[model samples]
Target: MRELLANRVKTLTPSATLAITAKAKELKANGIDVIGLGAGEPDFNTPKNILDAAAESMYQGHTKYTPAGGLPALKKAIIDKLARDNHLAYKPNEILVGIGAKHVLYTLFQVILNEGDEVIIPIPYWVSYPEQVKLAGGVPVYVESTSEQNFKITADQLRNAVTPKTKAVIINSPSNPSGMVYTREELIAIAEVAVEKDLLIVSDEIYEKLLYNGLEHFSVASISEEVKARTILINGVAKSHSMTGWRIGYAAGNAEIIESMTDLASHSTSNPTTTSQYATIEAYNGSQDSVEEMRAAFESRLETIYPKLNAIPGFKVIKPHGAFYLLPDVSEAAQKTGYTSVDEFVTALLTEANVAVVPGSGFGLPSTIRLSYATSLENLEEAVRRMDNFVRSKWQD
Candidate 1:
C-alpha cells in the first residue's frame, strides 16, 4: 500500500477517554454489568426553555444557514453574556461561533498556526488539545503541572516554556481531567506573562458555569484590555445548558483572529446549525435557573463521592473545586494491586471490576486516573465501591 493517510492525520492519537467509554458501552451491550465513569458530558437533558426556543426558531423559519460568523443576534447575546458574566466587552466582529468549543478550537489553531510553530499546552490537558495542535501543523510544547500543584501550571513554568516558535498557550480552567479552577490571582499572573511574551492566550471556558463550592469562574481576558487583546476565549452551552449535541461554541478576542476563523468556518462548517444558534441565544438570554440547578447537582455529587474515592486503598486525590470529574493518583494502588501501569489498571477495572475510567496518561499524567461524576449519584458511588473492591482483591499488601 502506497502511503495513504496524510502525515498530519497519521501523527494523531485517538481520544483515550472516548475509546474506553466505547469499550464500556460495548460490554454493557453484551449484558456485562459495566458502569462507565469515563463519559465527558452531563447526564442531564438540555433545559426545556432552550429546547422550546429551538422549536420556535424553526417555526419562525430559522432553519436555513446563518452568517458564517454567526448571526448578529447571537453575537449580541454572546457579547451580553461576556459583559454580564465575565465583565468583558466584545463586539460582534471579535466573536466567532462554530460547531462546539472543540471545533471552534480546531478552527482557531488552523488559522493561527504555521508549520512548526509551537503551542504551550499544560499537562493534564483535554485529550484533544495536543492532537489538534499537531493537525494544524504546530508542535505541542508541554509544561508539566503535577498533582502537588493542583494540576495547574505556574507563570514561571509557562515563561520557561516559551520560545520564539511559541505562538500561544492554552488555559482550561475547571480543567477537564483534573476539574481544577485557577484563582483570580493566578490568572492575573499568567496574563502578565502572556502579555509580556506576546503569546496568544487560548482560554477554554466551556466549564465556566459548572463551577462548585463557592468558586467563581474568572476569564483571564478580564485581567486587562492588553490581556484581552491577545486572548481568544472559547465557551459553549454544552457544559452549561447540557447542550452537548447542539454544537454551538464561540470564540471572543482579536478581530483579525475571529475574522480568519469565521472565514474558515464559512468554507468548512458553513455555519453552526441554525436551530442550535437560535437555541443558544435562548440559553444566554433566557432564564438561568436550570444552569444553577445543574451546577448544584454536580457539586452535591462531588461532595458525596470525593471522600469515598479518596478512601479507596492506595488512591490519593485532591478535592476539586469545579467540574464534574475526579483525577485520583492511583500509582500506589496500581502497584499494590500488582499491575505494572495505570493504563493496565484501567483495563482491569473495565473487564474485571466492570467499572471504567480514563487513564491519566492521555492527560500527560501517567500515574493517575480520571473518573467523571456526571453519572447518577447511585452509579457514582457503586463504581467507586467496585474499584475499591477490585484493588483489594489483587492487593499485594
Candidate 2:
C-alpha cells in the first residue's frame, strides 16, 4: 500500500494544528474537561445579516453554479473592497474566487510553480504555505526569523535567499502563529526586493482587518505599480467576517495568473459554494458593525490575556499587534517542567492540565507554543489559570 501511494502524497504531513484540535475534541468526547486553545477560528457565530443574505439568496433560488472565477457582482464587491480598504484597484478578470483562501492559494501555487522552483517562506509561517508549494511540485525555501525580530524576515534576508530557481516569496502580514505584522516601510523594502529580483509576491492578507494597537494594515500591492503587478493578494471573509465555514475566498493579481488559477478551479472545485459567494457579497457590502464587534472582542482578549500569559513562570510573550494568537516562548517552561521538547511539553499540558495548545514545531519554531485567544474571555482566563498552575506544579520544589 505504501509503495502504491504517489511520492507527492506520501511526502505530505498532516496539519499539526488540526491534529491537535482533533485530539482535544477526542479528549472532550471521553468527558474530559479540555480547554482548547489550539484552533484559530473565531468563536463568534456568523453575523445575522450575512446569514439573512444567504437565506435570501437561497429563497430567491440562487442555489445554482456560479462562474468558475466567481460571480461578477462578488468580484465587483471585492474590487471595491480593495480600492476602498487597501487602496488598490483591479478589474474583474484579475480576481479569482474559490473554496476558501486555502483552496485559492493551492490553485494559485499550482498555476504559478513548476518542478524545482523555490518559494521563499519566512519562518513561523502558516502551516499550509510550504505544504501547498510541495503539493505543486515546488521547493519551499525558508528564511528563518527569530523572536528578537518579531518573527519577521527582513528585505536583506529576502534578497539573499533569491536564486535562479526562485520564483516567488510569501508575505503573511498579521501573521499566523506569531501574530506579528510588517509595517508599510518594511513592506516597501521587501516589495523593492521583489521588484528588483523579479520574484512574485504572494501576500496573504486574510487577517488584514483584525489589526489593533493603532496599527494599520498595508497591502504589499498598494506600495507601488511595479510591485502591484508582481503581487498576488490572497484574502477572504474567513477571518474578517467570521465566515470560515462559508468557504469563500478570492485572489486578486496578475490577470494571466488569475485566469490560469480560475481555469484550474474550473476543473477542480467548479466554483465556490453558490450560497457562500452570495453571503460573502453581503459580508463585504453589508453593515461592517459585526466585523468591528468581533475585532473589539479579540483586541480586548489580547489586552487582558497577554499579561496573564506572560506572568506564567518561564513563559515569555510579546503583545501581538494583530491577529488572535499569542505565540509564547515556552522553552524555559519546558525545561523547568523536565520536558526535552516543546511537543512533549504541549502533550503533557493537554493530558495533565487539559489545556490544549499548538506546539511551535509545526510553525517552524520549536521553543515556542501558540495559543489562540479567539474563544471567549472567560475561556481564555480559565485556560491561562490552568496553564499557570500546571507550570507551577512541575517546578514546585
Candidate 3:
C-alpha cells in the first residue's frame, strides 16, 4: 500500500491544526470538559438572510451545477465587491470561483507553478499554503519574521529571498495565527520589490472583513496597474458571512491565469456547490450588517482576551489589529514547565488543562503558540483560566 502512493502524497504533512482540534473533540466525546481553541472559524451562525437566500435558490430550482468557474451573478457581485470595497476593477473573466478560498489557492498554484518553481511564504503563514505549494510540485521558500517585528517580513527580506526560480510571493494581510496586518506603506515597499523583481503576488485576503481597531485592509493589487496585473486576489464569504460550510470562494487576477485556474477547477471540482454560489451572491450583494456584527463580536473578544493572555505568566503577546487569533510567545512557559519545545507544551496543555491550541511550529514558528478567539467568550475565559492555573502549577518560583 505504501508503494502504491504517489510521491507527492507521501511527502505531504497532515494539517496539525485540524489534528489538534479533532483530538480535543475526541476528548469531549468521552465527557471531558475541553475548551478547544484550535479551530479557525467563527462561532457565529450563518446570518438568516444568507440562509434564506440559499433556501430560496433551491426552492427556485437552482440546485443544478453552475459553470465551472461560477455563476454570472456571483461573479458580478464579486466584481462589484472588489470595486466597491477594495477599489479594484475587474471583469467577470478575471474571476474564478471554487469550493473555497483554500481550493481556489490550490488551483492557482497548480495553474501557475512548474516543477521546482519557488513561492515566497512569510513565517506564521496559513497552515495550508506550503502544503498546497508542495502538492503542486512547487518549492516553498520561507522567510522568517520575528515576533519583535509582529511576525511581518520586510521589503529587504523579500528582496534578499528572491531568486531566479521564485515565481510568486504570498501576502496575507490581517494574517492568520499572528493576526498581523501589513500596512499600506509596507505593502507599497513590498510591491516595489515585486515590481522590480517581476514576481507575481498571491494576496490572500480571506480575513479582510475581520479587521479591528482603526486599521484598514489594503489590496496589493490596488497599488498600481502593473502590480494589479501581477497580483492574484483571493477571497470568499466563509469568514465574512460565517459560511465556512458553504464552500464558496473565488480568485481575481490576470484573465489568462484566472482562465487557466477555472479550467483546472473544471476538471477537479466541476463547480462550486450550486446552492453556495447563489448564497454567496446574496452574501456579496445583500445587506452587510451581519458581517459588521460578526466583526464587532470578534473584535470585542480580542479586546477582552488579549490582555488576559498577556497577564498569564511567561506568556508574552502583542495586541493585534485584526483577525481572531493571538500568537503568543510561550518559550518561557515551555521552559518553566520542564518542556523542551512549544509543541510539547501544547500537548501538555491539552492533556492536563483540557485547553487545545495550535503550536506555532505548524505555521513556521517554533517558540510561539496560536489561540483562536473565534469561539465564545465563555469558552475563551475558561480556557485562559485553565491555562493560567497550569502555568502557576508549573512555576519554578
Candidate 4:
C-alpha cells in the first residue's frame, strides 16, 4: 500500500511549523501543560470590520465562485494598497489572489518551475520555501547567512549561487524564524544583482507591516522599474491583520507572470474563499487601527522577551528587528548540556521545561532555535522562566 503512493509525495516532508504545532497539541491533549511557541500566527482575532464585511458578503450570496485572478474589486484594493502604502503602482490585472501567502508561493513555483530549475533561498527562511521548491521539481540552492550579518545574504553570495538554470530567488523580508528585515540598501544591492543576473524575485512580504522600532520594510518591486518588472510582490492580511484563519493573500507582478499564476489557481483551487476575498477588501481599504494595535503588541512582547532570553548565562539572542520571533543561538547550551545536537537540546527543553520551540536547524541554522512571540506576554514570560530554570538545573558541562 505504501508503495502505491506517488514518488513525488514520497520525497515530501511536512512543514516543520505545522508539525511542531501538531506535536504541541498532542502533548497538551495528553494532559501535559505544553506552551507552544512554534506557530507563526498572531494571537489576535480578526478585526471587527473584517468580520462584518465577511458577514455582508455571505448575506449578499457571495458564496458562489469568484474570478480566478480574484474579484475585480479586491484586485483594485490590492493595487491601491501597493500605491498608497508601499509607493509602488500595480494594475488590477497584475494581481493574483490565493488562499494565503503559502498558496501564492506554491502556485508561483507550480507555474514557472521546470525540473532542475534552481531557486536561491537565503537560510533561516520560512520553513516551507525549500520544500515548496522541491515539490515544484526545482532544486533549492540555499545560501547560508549568519547572526553576525543579521541573517541576510550578501550580493557576492548571490552572484556565486546563480547558474544558467536559476529561475528565481525567494526574498522574504521580516523573515520568519529569524525575524530579520532586510534594509532598503541591502534590498537595492540584491536587486542590482538580480537585474545583472536576470533572475526572477519572489518577494514574500507577508510580515512587512509587523516591523518594529523605526525600521522600515522596503518592497522589492519598489526598488526600481527593472525589479518591479521581475519581482512578484506577495503579501496578505494573515500576519498584518491577524486574519490567519480567513486565508486571503495576493501577489502583484508582471502581468504575464500573474496571468500564469491566475491560470494555475483557476485550474487548481479556483478563487480563494469568496468570503475571505470580501473580508480582505476591507482589510486593505478599511481603517488600520487594528493592524497598529497588533504591531504594538508584538513590539512590547519583543521588549519583554529579548532581554530575558539574553540574560540566561549561555544563551545568545539577536534582537529581531521585525516580526514576532527571537532566534537565539543555543549551541553553547547544547554543549554545556552534553546534547549531541540542537535537535536533542530542543527535545530536552520541551520535555523538561514543557515549552515547545521550533529548532533553528529546521530553518537551516543548526546552532540556534526559533521561538515565536505571537502569544500573550504572560505565556512568553512563563515560558522563558521555565526554560531558564531547566537550563540551569540540567545543562552542566
TM-score of 1: 0.99
Compared with the true structure, all predictions reach lDDT values of: 0.94, 0.94, 0.93, 0.90
Model 1: per-residue lDDT, tens digit, 1-397? Answer: 8998777788788999989989999999999999999999999999999999999999999888789989899999999999999999999899999999999999999999999999999998999999999999999999999878999999999999999999999999989989999999998999999988999999999999988878888999998888999999999999999999999999999999999999999899898999999999999999999999999999999999999999999999999988889999999999999989999999999999999999999999999999999999999989999999998889997
Model 3 Cα shift for residue 25 (angstroms): 0.6
Cα lDDT tens digits, model 3, 1-397, are 4588778988777898999999999999999999999998898999998899999999999988889999999999999999999999999999999999999999999999999999999998899999999999999999999878888999999999999999999999989988999999999999999999999999999999999887778999999999999999999989888999998899999999999998888898999999999889889999999999999999999999989999999999988888889999999999998899999999999999999999999999889999999999999999999999999999874
lDDT of 4: 0.90
Clashing pairs in 2: none
TM-score result, candidate 2: 0.99
**Local distance difference test, candidate 3:** 0.93
Which residue ranges in model 4 land beyond 4 Å of their true spot?
A: none
Q: How accurate is candidate 2 locally (lDDT)?
A: 0.94
Global local distance difference test of model 1: 0.94
The count of residue-pair clashes in candidate 1 stands at 0
Error of 2 at 204 (Å): 0.2
The residue ranges of model 2 lying beyond 4 angstroms of the native Cα positions read: none
lDDT of 1 at 200: 97
TM per candidate = 0.99, 0.99, 0.99, 0.98
What are the per-residue Cα lDDT tens digits for candidate 2 across 1-397?
4577778988887898999999999999999999999998899999999999999999999999889999999999999999999999999999999999999999999999999999999999889999999999999999999888999999999999999999999999999988999999999999999989999999999999899998888899998888999999999999999999999999999999999999998999889999999999999999999999999999999999999999999999988898899999999999988999999999999999999999999988999999999998999999999999999999733
